[model samples]
Target: MKKYLPLIIAILLLALAYLTGYSKYIGLAWYGKATLIGGAGGIILTLGAYWFDKNRLNITLIALFAITTAVTYYYARIFIDSADFEPTAGFVWYIGYHIGVALFIPTVAYILQKILPQSASIE
Candidate 1:
């Protein structure tokens, strides 16, 4: 269950984003929804990659994630550009940022845990 916590969190985020009407806060119509969905998809894919590779950070996962993200960004341009609200931060940029965090968070957590003096006592 601990290993799958990230996946559970990702699923919950998607639920909250759509089911709770949080997408409306980003923009009107499909723009906000698409961005939130795509971004959540990115997070889910990264965390879910652990099912295939134990190494949360790995070449194959990175490559696959990059390809998927590119495809998502390309297809999302129409709705993103047509957003009713002014897009201050580039839509694709925010999505990529979220994906970037997803890709690296595991390693960061690992490093943080090991860096603490408490790790020595635990080991």
Candidate 2:
């Protein structure tokens, strides 16, 4: 049960963000702040997952990325005007964004894990 905590927390966060209409605020200040918070949360949760199970880091990160992308896309489609939403271009950008976050958050978390004292445990 403990091993699944990070993924659970991530799913909850994704659900909260989705239900709250978070993506509807894109291009606004609150959306930027939300992105930062979400990014930090992702790093923390991914790090926790990594600590709990070193072997499953990649899968955990991928799952988190997929959740984020799905939620973002879902809300974007509803709120954004179809005239401005190019399916191909938007999807390509979304993929790029996911790749960037999926790679960056874990790398930063790994570095922070190494830098911080071993006594500091996320669990």
Candidate 3:
């Protein structure tokens, strides 16, 4: 389960992200701040799996989490003002956003750790 978890999460997030981004029907409805207990709540719950080995407080992960959270927060501040449907100012929502913009480097690192030959993994 641990080994396959990342891929599973990636798939699920990819799906939600697709629905939320591409579909015309869904968009922000309510206005509020969502606090995740830890690690962007690790949107990668759905996303942060790649960074799981590191403690949630690790500076790198923390920075990534902050970036994702801030991004979503601002997306709301700048784009979403009311309860009605409005065309998105951007192509996608940056928070919890399918592995996240801030997390891309980590995800790639995680993938490399898994896919590249074992010899290459030697530190």
TM-score of 2: 0.38
Question: Candidate 3, which ten residues in sequence have the lowest lDDT sum?
Answer: 28-37
Candidate 1 lDDT at 73 equals 69
- lDDT tens string, model 1, 17-120? 55677745633124554555555555556556565664443554557667757866684765467654346336555655455434433433334333545523
TM-score for every candidate vs. truth? 0.39, 0.38, 0.33
Off by over 4 Å in 1: 27-48, 57-61, 68-123
Each model's lDDT comes to: 0.50, 0.53, 0.43
Candidate 3 stretches with Cα past 4 Å from truth are 1-57, 82-84, 89-104, 107-123
- The Cα RMSD in angstroms, rounded to one decimal, for candidate 1 relative to the true structure is 8.3
How much is the lDDT of residue 109 in candidate 1?
A: 34
Q: Which TM-score value belongs to model 3?
A: 0.33
Q: Which candidate achieves the best TM-score against the true structure?
A: 1
Q: Distance (Å) between predicted and true CA of 119, model 1?
A: 11
Ranking by TM-score: 1, 2, 3
Candidate 3 lDDT by residue in tens digits, 43-77: 34424533454323245556766877777776677
